[model samples]
Target: MTTAYYTHADCKRHEMGSWHPESPERLQAIEDQLIASRINTLLDYREAPAALESDLARVHTADAIYRIRENCPSERSEYDHFPLDADTSLNAYTWRASLRAAGAAVAATDAVIDAEIENAFCAIRPPGHHATSKEAMGFCMFNNVAVAAKHALEVRGLQRVAIVDFDVHHGNGTEEIFNGDQRVLMVSFFQHPYYPYSGTEHPASNMVNVPVPAHSYGNVIRELVSERWLPALEAFKPEMIFISAGFDAHREDDMGQLGLVEADYAWITQQIMRVAKTHSHGRIVSCLEGGYNLSALARSVTAHVKILADLE
Candidate 1:
């Protein structure tokens, strides 16, 4: 089985604004880099499906879903200014694009769980680690990774699932959704004193949050994951693994100051793959999160996915 790459054209249509860092060009940049690097030749590509309402309802409340739908613009001009938060906005196509992004995660989950693919990477946009159970914040509309974890447990009958978030910002939404749930173990690393800053304080028991200082190098991240994340993950013995794969932590990205390079992402991917191979039969599903600097994000993701595809 090969690595599955899932994306959709609708994802590019959901634009926050022309100036937003999470632009539609983000997807094009990654895809262009993958094509240029010959990484596209090593993977099986699939178009993402639109998420079913029932599937999204698994993680987000019905009211939240209804609010998003109600807020959707009827026409392109109607959504000149639809705001979820100060940073997050919605346009006419935002709802459909969000559904497709979330659906990519669900489909990737199904592929891994059914053994049709050893692993998968969702090259989707309007990234989803920050959207909580009811609120959409931090450029996220729905918790895509959270929905996949819930589906794996509720539908696939998986006893335990682990979510590893390597985003520059904390996955407060995902943590809020799965906190105290014994079946889920969440390991995350984010730059402290950053955007949506509330991860360092009281955290859930199942959450292993390691806040790295600004300008810290990849060695610090490697040490933290080795000491804190791996031990907890080993003890949890998750039946499946999910990755909230964000590449904004790269040194070239202006979003955060953690000094991670492409090789660092590749190393982390190998570590996660080691855990998946040992405990979960190599079932790993990775969904995109935050990655800004076009060249760095594309290069880092290529390094990350190449490892996931076992090309290196």
Candidate 2:
């Protein structure tokens, strides 16, 4: 499989702070691991282009887009930060980086649909899935996967798509954006009683929000995917699959209390690939979301991408 690895240098410059867990070093670490594992040479590497304003308009309101664009601290010092929320901050490079992050997803979607590649993995940040249509929060500036899903449906003329989120925290933004939209089916399992918790209560029918408890191990996750996510995905028979790829649930990651390891990630990705192969013509686009512990995040991503690239 010709898997494209999409990323950009601008994505590495959108720093919140030196102490933030979602640092640019996270991308660097993933790259290091991919190189160390000898997986980098097997895939196609592409620079992420800036997303057009029209692309942003598909999923974000004009006001919301204006707010983010106007809030860039371009003329300020390197240390200056414009806070979007308590956790999310915009540095001078954030605007450009946000465009690049979202753009990577859009470009990857187009590339996959055009059959230029079998699948893709976007190593981008500030991690999305937390940013909503109306607001940016939780260290996220834009809903990258949501934007790409919209692109596939609205721009590319696809009728249906599925989003699989394995992040430790709920993808409140993604759920909200496509809540009542019939064209997309979202399946996710997050730590209940966790940060930005909103997936459990009466989500729309299109959303399969399975809330697992903290300290839940990989087996619990695997079982839920088989029993819950798989059924919905098979029933939906999506034309494409989008993944909010997050590694924060790793046992070694302090971002959340979950016992997932690299093997678990590989298995989950394999399952997604199976579904994609059966229904979506092996078309999948995955975007980075959250992962704190650098070592764990790097290893887990390497494992996940190995499966995406069919290296295993």
Candidate 3:
């Protein structure tokens, strides 16, 4: 089976702002590298479908959902109103793009569960994981990975799912959505005392929140995964694995102070795949989260995807 690649043009339309770091160029950079490396030919490509309201409702509250939609301005052409938070905003295309972002994860999950592909990578935007059950923050409108994890459990009849987030910022939102759910095991690390600044506090038992120091190198992250994440993940033995694949932790990206590179991303993907092979029958659905620097983000993502597609 081939690895499935999912994305859509709408994702590019959900522009935060020209000055914003999470620009549509991020997607273009990845696609360009995939083509340049000829890795695009090794995978199956599909347009991401819009996420159904019912699937979104499983993870996000009705109030949060309604607010995002109600806040979406219909009259705007080039730009839209600032949103509930300063960092995130709603353009005319944000609503549609957010749905597709969440939907891509759902579609990826479906493809993996159905054995249509060995694995899947969703190249979506309006990066989720920062948006909470109650509000959106940190350049996010919807919690995409959380929605997919919920779908795997509630819709697909899966008992356990693991979320692996290597984003530079803490996925406070994902942790909030799956706080009390024992069936979901989340192992992640982020730069501490940074934006949203909440991972250090008391987290839920099911959540393995590792707060790494600023400017840490790949060795530090590798140690965390081997010493901490692997044990928790192995014990969980999830039926499926989901990844919040963020590449901003790269040393070249000004978004965070972490000292990771493209090789680091591939290393983590390999580690996650090993766990999937042992327990989850090699089922994995990964979606984009952060990673702002265009060139570094592209290289890092291609590295992660190469490993996911076994082209590495």
List lDDT for all candidates, in order: 0.91, 0.94, 0.91
Instruction: Quote each prediction's TM-score.
Output: 0.98, 0.99, 0.98
Model number with the top lDDT: 2
Worst 10 residues of 1 by lDDT: 72-81
Better of 2 and 3 by lDDT: 2
TM-score of 2: 0.99
- Please write out the lDDT profile of model 3 over residues 1-312, one tens digit for every residue: 589999999999888778989899999999999999899988899999999999889888899999888777784465766567777888888889999999999999998999999899999998999989888889999999999999999999999999999999999999988997999999999999898798878888999999999989999999999999999999999899999998999999999999999988999999999999999989999999999889999999899998988886
Stretches of model 3 off by over 4 angstroms after superposition: none
Give lDDT: candidate 1, residue 20. Answer: 93
Identify the leading candidate in terms of TM-score.
Answer: 2
Predictions: Cα RMSD each: 1.1, 0.7, 1.0
Candidate 1 lDDT score relative to the true structure:
0.91
Model 1 lDDT tens row, 1-312: 589999999999888888999999999998999999898988999999988999999999888898788887777484474888899988888889999999999999998888899999999977999988998899999999998899999999999999999998999999999988989999999999888796788887988999888998999999998999999988998899999999988999999988999999999999999999999999999999999999999999899999999888
For residue 24, give model 1's deviation from the true position in Å: 0.5
Model 2, 48-163: lDDT tens digits are 99999899888888888888899888655867898878888889898899999999999999999999999999999878898889989898888999999999998999999999
Q: Which wins on TM-score, candidate 2 or candidate 3?
A: 2
